[model samples]
Target: MGDTANNTENAPKKSFFKGVKSEFNKIIWPDKQTLAKQSAAVVAISVALGVVIAIVDIGVVYGIEQILKIG
Candidate 1:
């Protein structure tokens, strides 16, 4: 009875790792050229977004300063 319980517990762990390995083998990884293009696109978008945020911040600060001066 004890041996049967131990085998049942270990059976799931062994099958789970086997399933993980099978899934990894099925993956189609991206090529280096595709990876580089995607990385560059992400970086360019990040920089463009940063510049837009900075411009908006400058405009807000200037507007607030003008309002304070009017008071």
Candidate 2:
């Protein structure tokens, strides 16, 4: 009865690390060509988003300035 309790107590910690090790071994890293392609995609998307935000910012600022001028 005591051994059963002890086993149940330690079961989770042992299984957790074993599962982690199993998952880590399954990883297949990208090759150089794939890495470069993905990197470029990320950079391109980031720059596109920045440009969009800048345009929106400029529009907002211009609108506020025109409103203030009219008042």
Candidate 3:
């Protein structure tokens, strides 16, 4: 009974890896130029978003400080 339970647990893991391998094999990887462009776009967008968030955060902090001073 114990052996059967262990085998059942391992069976799912084995099948999962097999399925993952099959899916990976089907993927069409991007070429070097396309990959480089995509990576650069991602980096640029991330930096822009970070700057916007930082500006918003600073504005909020300054507003809070002004309110505290008024109080």
Better of 1 and 2 by lDDT: 2
Model 3 C-alpha RMSD to native = 3.4
Q: Which whole-number lDDT from 0 to 100 does residue 26 have in model 1?
A: 100
Q: Quote each prediction's TM-score.
A: 0.79, 0.78, 0.72
* 1-71 per-residue lDDT for model 2 (tens digits): 79999887877687789999999999999999999999999999999999999999999999999999999
Question: What are the candidates' C-alpha RMSDs?
Answer: 3.9, 3.4, 3.4
The digit string of per-residue lDDT tens for model 3 on 1-70 reads 7999988777757778999999999999999999999999999999999999999999999999999999
How far off is residue 5 in model 1, in Å?
13
Best-fitting candidate, measured by TM-score? 1
Which stretches of model 2 miss by more than 4 angstroms? Answer: 1-8
Each candidate structure's count of clashing pairs: 0, 0, 0
Ranking by TM-score: 1, 2, 3
**Measured by TM-score, how close is model 3 to the native structure?**
0.72
lDDT at position 31, candidate 1: 100
